[model samples]
Target: MLHRFDSFLASRRRFLQVSAGFGVSLMLPALEGRAAERRGAERATSLITLWMNGGPSQLETWDPHPGTVIGGPTRAIDTSVPGLQIAADLPRMAERMKHLSVIRSLTSKEGDHERGTYFVKTGYRPDPTVTHPAIGAVVPYQLGTDHLEIPAYVSLGGGEWPGRGGYLGDQHDAFRIFEPGNSIQNLRARVSDKRQERRLSGLDVVSQTFRAQRQVQAERSLHGQTIDKALRMMSSEQLEAFEVDQESEATLQRYGDSSFGRGCLVARRLIETGVRSVEVTLSGFDSHANNFETQTARCEQLDPAFASLLDDLRERDLYDSTIILCLGEFGRTPRINGLEGRDHWPGGFSCVVGGGGLKSGQVIGATDPEGEQTSPVDPVPVQNLYATILQQLNIDPAEELITPIGRPLAICEGSLIPKLLVDAG
Candidate 1:
């Protein structure tokens, strides 16, 4: 009974849909958006990045090179580790020096803000062709943990960040949450028990029908995977873990009052409960004008919450297994700029790394007299840092992520920073 005209039209639609299902931009954009490229994720690795988005100045943080004409008001004080000094504002970190390291010579070739951020997040530099995957995406897609009910990566940002699970597909996108809502937004189902179950069942039927009727190899394969993951999320009885308020009263108080504190508390609980990655962002640090006043208050908010998070992890015996990184896209200028605030300085910045069984109490590299410039031997490129993170978690730093069109794009282009290797064989 099928008419030739109707059949031809249906075929054409199927072809167009299938073509759209795979895009070259799926891999690193420079890789011609090659499809199917995947990098191996380290299953045991877990990271909690305390991102201070925009830019935090090196003059006020980990790399305080006082005594230089270029250096500002903040003076460097010695840490527990000999021959090392950091800014006065980071008092807690100075005393707790045995657990941290400073990579003061981090320099980036890309001066533009957006592009620099992109390069740091992805191992490769920004290219026009392929959109790269953030480590958040790289986590669940390659390194899935066992018995985790919630999504692998959970990112808590007050507003939208230029975050993406590029080339890895939309399935790897983070479960985003913000404040006022407190817990994750849109994660709570609207319907009651009966309706929720019924709706899920209906979804299953529709998904099954679509797959059976429209099976075009790769498209069918992708859809099938999404459905399977969705069903697991739906069926999990432990989804309540996302709502950490289920814990005792004292547990919540331990993390403190601010949203960052709450976010860190949630991260601690998530990692303990088995989510692979959690990224917590604290905003307003891009103080381009009133630098000192802004950073002092910002650090005050950051200090207690950060210290407590680390302390809580150890108290729960999770410290050794979890890694914490506090970073920003770039550092502010050493010379108080024309605006009275430190402007963007990609020349030298500092990032803090701790736990995950890596070597601690180490200062990996150095910057010049005022932390204004990177010393030649101590240059820490963005790729090198990414590679070091991958290595610490037992991922093969040099592994090739296969692109969709069969080209292998380099994942971690640099070797792991030697000093941070803990159990590396």
Candidate 2:
């Protein structure tokens, strides 16, 4: 859907046939040039996003106002960090609190699922003029693609997928896999390497003619690059990272026996292999009805997996070099509705950020006792969150990338949250 290359070429099945018959492959257009080189010391080498989609409740997750009417039945539990408490459902994550920083008062104006997801992921709201790249897309752009065999960005399961490269082009789109531990389809070459070479040789003549025509060289280039990348990835040893079953049974148990757990494990593997950014989604957080029960269940699923991921990363010495972010488009309301479920509340919410050598074991902001307004602090906008992530990745948040329409847009418009940055060397 991101492109219209099919108009000029036959079906993919036929394109391969023509390549085999002709010799040279037509390349797809390279939309938008690569971002400028990383501007600062890299605080993190990779990013792992645990997307708690469908708008997780702030009260049941990181911002529980225990004993308050707004807190419902969710009780607060002590974390390893003194005086820092979270909802009881995430006891394991509570234990790992020393490795985390919770923003209890994240604020946003967009409450619609589509709009909030876009704002949080791209650091920009939906605009008629230009589509912005997701943080996942921008990270890879700033980091470059020298060592990546698999796509630089990978998305596990569903959700908004962070972003599909937006104006940065589909080249940066996440290589989507619906489930963890499943082999990617079409990865195996149907023909031998020698046969593939022959096919390429066959396509060379046709590609030359296509280039001579110059009617769609950019599109041709884009397609060729995409094919080349896919072919290389099909043969990449790094692809084995997706196989969660290869991990020990005990390790799997530590992460819990759920799809989200498997996804967390796979995320670790992908990050270890140098994938720049990866997002793992755990859906069904929308608790518009039966809010308490739904939130409790979702948090229970999130706890062990999230804790185990932190533990495994630390044991493997990957924790310091990786960042973990957990949040959704927005947070559910503080007031329990007639359905006993909370509605959307973009005014105040919570999110967790840790690792990447960030300052940890701290709470960034707070909401009132009733969980109504972001009290004692200004609201944390979506742009600030994006800026913080980019800063940790060594990408200058102020840098601009030219859009397809030639507009120079800043990667993130917000200033850095000093509390979240690494200590100056």
Candidate 3:
């Protein structure tokens, strides 16, 4: 009787183990499907970052204090919005202020170019232990790129410090295009179609052998996934979105003839084709000397491109679904240096954000007009800006992602900027 009871107990334990394993296996697909559904519902929006690569001066751009000691020769001009005005250099942008909101008190701690760019782009300080994903990378990571044949993140006119995938892996990295409107190199096969197919098949055989030898599954290998994505993108009709020349001559003139202008136009095209994020960089903002002249030239390239981008988005009925962020690594110092230049100032600066259902035509914070106070009024941290953006995109900023090293990190650790959101206010 004792032997029979023990046998029954052992069999019951095995059955329970198998049942548990089976139950977990069944739960995984259901969980994944739910997650997919949620992502699909949330991913209708896109982000366009107009990166002012080098630090631009607040006094010469968004937060001009004309007639003040630190305001310099850059004058302030009225905008379509009743109470708001921007630098006279951005006359075109000034007229379209009703579609944008300027944050005049964006403050950060990293002043160096590399560090500042990483912080502003990633919303986290540099940590040797783990690199955080850029906002662009995070967009695709949380949203999923099942709908895109082209890379979800794209960088036009690549900058010194372009947005990176960081801990999310290289698959999320931006596809860099040095110039817009040019044919993408290496996209088409140099050989005949038959030869290309034969080569691909030969490569696949070798890849299969390699996977078998290593005991690695083909689907689990990053290299294999990358190759698959490349092939898909090569054949994708979505690649045509990069052709800015397809626009009319009037449209081209409206956006200006500069590279940055064309980049902005291409950005709109990419967004229309379901790209999660697009960054159009306008470099040369670093003005350690000749701040006024440098800023004026930069703004000339910026004003028309930026204003026309907003106009196009609104005209195409894409404005409400696309978020636009125009900012840089930091701002130039309020004090003009001996070389007639403004030094790097992470103390306070300005960033313009609007669309994606956000409130517009409003200035969020202010700077000290007299320039006596270095700290800005109602100062906003870089993390808060990211948090607000994530919230707008339907991503939970507090959600934690476990790193490969078993460390967990939150997407963002800051609170939302209530005034920036349409529903929050």
Candidate 4:
């Protein structure tokens, strides 16, 4: 059910293909009514998800069990916060830990890649009965503005399964931007305005005839709105948000020359322009073999970009208004395998959440010295994490949203983790 927008910008030389392709408006009026709820209110305005695609090793990350059998030679370094240490590989992030907090005892049972990804992203297991909207999809659907010229949810470097709109409809699907700083293909038209108008007019006639014959009033309305949204996106003056080149070379270098860095830069720009949610994914953390080597390489890519993003955001005074979340589907096992790698372990993991009015430099929970669950009362489930995120965003996790089929669904079906909030004790 993953949808890609890359080919949607394919050539328009063939009139039939061109005519069939686009819609300018996205009329999800269902979404418009669902403004962010005020319960458990926080003043956050945007979210940037640093999505560690594969399961990252908690031992090598925020919850390193140094000097233990499972520690695996990954030394812990002191962070800005006294007595708090993270993997030595993330030195830059270590210095930035004052704005960050770690939940070291997140637990889940979904180990398979796709299943785990779905659970983490949607706060629900995959269900054939109902395709759930991802957090990214939900935020924009609930908080997006009518006058927004930019797509509310944007994905940078998200591979095949970038999450979907589910019952939210195709309109809420993330606008996937494969190249962070570069312009998206086909955003500008090849033909003159007059020619384009003629083509659209012809398509309108055909659409009207089809609507008259099929009498699919709802479908027609949705389609028309989609077209309108597409059209608006193409001509948006705010489209400059995608241009990271506008940033100075020094700034770009600070974030690093990597795609992930560029993506973070683009994410910041998008947030400044009022995008509700943006996800920047870093792949290759699934270290079933050669765990240390692979993890070190991955951290080399993540540390600079993430640390730079936090610094720049704070420098610009955007930190309080934005939530920066860094996580993966699960975590690597505490035991190193025969191949010197770690297998997937959803039982105990770690995630870093910062800004957005969250209390900083605090560890929420922990694991035993043997890298096992410390207590049944300690583990934070995915649902609770999602609930905390929503609450911090000024959204009510308990508020129900009606699915297209008339079924009521809460924005997030989990209890709030009060310790994660700035105002909480």
Clash count for each candidate, listed in order shown: 13, 22, 0, 14
Task: Score each candidate by Cα lDDT.
Answer: 0.65, 0.77, 0.81, 0.78
**For model 1, how big is the CA root-mean-square deviation?**
9.8
Error of 2 at 251 (Å): 1.2
Q: Please give each candidate's TM-score.
A: 0.80, 0.87, 0.88, 0.89
| Candidate with more favorable, higher lDDT: 1 or 2 | 2
Question: If the candidates were sorted by their TM-score against the true structure, best first, what order would they fall in?
Answer: 4, 3, 2, 1
Superposition TM-score, candidate 1 onto the true structure? 0.80
Q: How high is the lDDT of residue 273 in model 3?
A: 71
**Which pairs of residues clash in candidate 3, taking residues 3 or more apart in a chain or in different chains?**
none
- Candidate 3 lDDT, 279-332, residue by residue in tens: 999999999999999999999999999999999888777778889999999999
The global Cα lDDT (0 to 1) of model 1 is 0.65
**Per-residue lDDT of model 2, residues 101-191, tens digit only:** 9998787878898888878877787886777888988897898765556777888886644466778876666666778777765555567
Indicate which candidate wins on TM-score: 4
The regions of model 1 sitting more than 4 angstroms off are: 1-43, 75-77, 185-231, 234-240, 246-254, 370-377, 423-425
Error of 4 at 296 (Å): 0.6
Q: For candidate 2, give the lDDT of residue 238.
A: 72
